[model samples]
Target: MRRRGIDALTHRAVAEEAALPPQTVRAHLPTREDLWCAALQYTLTGWVRRGEEFIDRLPEPLTLEQAARAIVEVATVHPAEHADTTRATIAGVYERYIQSGRHPELRPLIGRYNVELTGLVARVLARHGRHVQPEIARAVLAVVDGTVVYRLAEGETPIPAAIRALEVAIPLLCPFPNDT
Candidate 1:
């Protein structure tokens, strides 16, 4: 589902990708929705785990600037070096996010992701002494999501350059001046 869009996700395709028999895939997944929902859950759970690891690695007595950059970096960079795969995952998630509008059944699953992401950003901001607000967290997420979408749309912006740009832009857009 990451490399290809939803339309391309069929039992045979999934089985081929997994190097498993079609019968095995069908026995496990049962239906298309079951497979897609499971895939979404797996991808999102991985993302949340990575975000937590990034936060754990932040420096003690983290300055506002460092916190801001670290948070943006998590949003922008793929830590396991699977940048392309990560990009594909993001694209897949974005598709599901859009599909949820029409399908509705995907709402709770995708909505949990939105809530988790907002909470992750909010915790980072608060760690750096910012007064945590839901609006601020949502705004930060919006900027990150928009930046990522632009990167995907253009297919040109180098991830490193985009990461640097986001690090610089975050403080300007949502300043958290260092009191240290």
Candidate 2:
């Protein structure tokens, strides 16, 4: 159902595809929105799980560049598995988040993860370059997210492109001593 994209799915269609009775499918997913949300949430959970695993594998006190590179790499590698649905769902979620004033419960989860990532970046900036600022960390994150979205939309998983972009942007954001 997911591989074919959201348009290909209906309650009856999904039930048939799953070889389950329509009523049984309806019991689990009462509406098209429910099905899509479930699929998206499932995809998101997998992403979160992968991120946790990657964090666990990291050496203590990962530098900003290392953390950024790790995140880009993981996002690049995993999203290629379900690029279509995942991208669509991400677009949907971002739109919903922007359009509605209410925050989703998942917002905190995302914020916490981002805080950890940006904090690492800020630490690296403080240690290796000039003063670190919250805005600098945020700009770095925006670049990474934009790059990931672009690569996913192009049906390409170019880790090198992401890495290079981050490497270039990092200095601009932090302005290392040699950058001058």
Candidate 3:
């Protein structure tokens, strides 16, 4: 569902994209809700993986500025490559995130995502030698989510706006800075 919202996802479409028989796809997904959950799970898992991978690539004991910038840029779109695909994925995730209120089946997935994301934010802060409460980590997530939605609503590239907003907002969100 990277190129379209979850509403557009179908077993046939997925089968075609994956070059598998439609029956195989249906056997795995079974229903629209199943497909929706699977698609969302895939996207959400990728997002978490992206953050973990970014962190893995960093040198040990990151500087505050490095960790701050890494947290801002890690999960957002990479501007120079696969820009459209990244934008679509980001939009699709937000769309799924909002759908959790209407679709009870999706609430578990969203909850898991939020927990993982909260940990990611916290990890970035810890890497910079500043440990924060879970609420503060979630606030970091809130800033990025709000900025992304605003940019998307304005028909602009969300990544740049997210970067700009996070750079300003993250320091303020952290409880305190470690002088290391």
lDDT of 3 by residue, 1-180 (tens): 767766678999999999999999999889989998998898788888888877777776877556656665554623323444566556766777777787899899989988987888788778877788989888887887888788788877777566667667766777454522
The digit string of per-residue lDDT tens for model 1 on 26-53 reads: 9999988787777778777877888888
Q: Which ten residues in a row have the lowest lDDT in candidate 2?
A: 94-103
Q: Which of the numbered candidates is closest to the native, going by highest lDDT?
A: 3
* Poorly placed runs, candidate 2 (over 4 Å): 63-65, 77-138, 149-157, 174-180
lDDT of 1 at 82: 48
Question: Would you list the clashing residue pairs of candidate 1?
Answer: none
What is residue 165's positional error in candidate 2, in angstroms?
A: 1.1
lDDT: the better of candidates 1 and 2:
1
Tens digits of per-residue lDDT for model 2, 135-164:
887787677678766775786644555666
What ranges in model 3 sit over 4 Å off? 75-89, 177-180
Candidate 1 has an lDDT of 0.69
Candidate 1: list runs displaced more than 4 Å.
Answer: 77-96, 99-103, 155-180
Score residue 126 of candidate 1 by CA lDDT.
73
Measured with C-alpha atoms, the lDDT of residue 139 in candidate 2 is 86
TM values, all candidates: 0.74, 0.58, 0.81
lDDT score, candidate 3, position 14: 96
Whole-model Cα lDDT of every candidate shown, in order: 0.69, 0.59, 0.75
